[model samples]
Target: MATDQHLTEHTTAREELLKGHVLHVVRDTVRLPDGASATREYVLHPGAVAIVPLLDDGRIVLERQYRHPTRQVHVEIPAGKLDAGEGALACGQRELLEETGYVAREWAYAFTMYPTVAYSDEAIEIWFARGLEHRGARLDEGEFLDVIAATPEEFLGWVREGKVNDAKTLASALWIQNVLAGTWKLDWQAPPDQP
Candidate 1:
């Protein structure tokens, strides 16, 4: 009988499997609630932030880049992993500028989601940004991508057609749709040190 009071798995042993630049893998042995033991493998992530950048003209910013693992070009909202001790909002701002050459005067923290709950501890913070101003992009060396601008409806259509299947992008597009429709509310705020 797995009840709320005794359902938590106890970690009996843990081993670091691999430590890469972006991904850290670990294997754990756990004692189950029913007194059974099992091994679980998962990735340790630093977490990341994804931004839904809404321009004043009602278009949203996106990116199409080649993903090595999938070997496919994926359309995604501007996002990046959090640097050590970096705030999510700052990471969002940085990614937006570097990836899309845009900046937003107003920003909002939308929601947090876990994309691979079964196998990874990766959390993505979704952010909403508006009052945008365009600047020249400063892409990282060797970073190649095409910037795309589209309305929420267009993005939703892509999602329906299986063209935008990246988990974080799908979530961001949904957030954009509802937020623009007034069904979802965001606590929008001015960028720091600004009115």
Candidate 2:
């Protein structure tokens, strides 16, 4: 096994393979720890945020939407990619509002995860929200999804039954379970610039 410092792959050369509207693919020549050379290809991603909106009724907001690549509708937490120069928290708040029509009074930073670390540098920050008010969704044009409420138990069950397959959502659900069980602690705070 290699030590931490020895595990680093030094990029010697890079080639831009493709650049889509949201995805940028690259191929890189790297120097391995043992002075070997190899090629690595991966996707460069603009980080994103996912929010677990906890309603006052003890249920959380969820969405059912079609995922084109998978060709299957999946249940997920409200989430969105961070726009250029946008903060993760702001993206979370914006996504929650646009996707679910919900605004949260309390927001807690929960977890940050790499959904596809092996080949992609994508990260999804998870947030927990409460003190919600329904203000009606402001979805982006061409966006179509159904908003629903589910207890943590129900969501977890879906996960266990292989229903909730989205990586970030499953991790967020686990965070919720631990938070509710007092095993995980969340630092709740008001958004900056808000009274």
Per-residue lDDT over 48-78 for candidate 2, one digit per residue giving the tens place of the 0 to 100 score: 9999999998898999999999999999998
| Residue ranges of candidate 1 with Cα displaced over 4 Å | 1-3, 193-195
With candidate 1 superimposed using the best TM-score fit, by how many Å does residue 176's alpha carbon deviate from the native? Answer: 1.5
Candidate 2 wrongly placed segments (more than 4 Å): 1-3, 193-195
Clashing pairs in 2: none
Q: Please give the range of 10 consecutive residues that has the lowest summed lDDT in model 1.
A: 186-195
Q: Each prediction's Cα lDDT score?
A: 0.90, 0.90
Residue 30: error of model 2 in Å?
0.7
**Native-to-model Cα distance after best TM-score fit, residue 175 in candidate 2, in Å:** 0.6
TM-score of each: 0.94, 0.96
Clash statistics: count for each candidate: 0, 0
Q: What is the lDDT of residue 126 in candidate 2?
A: 91
lDDT of 2: 0.90
Top-TM-score candidate index: 2
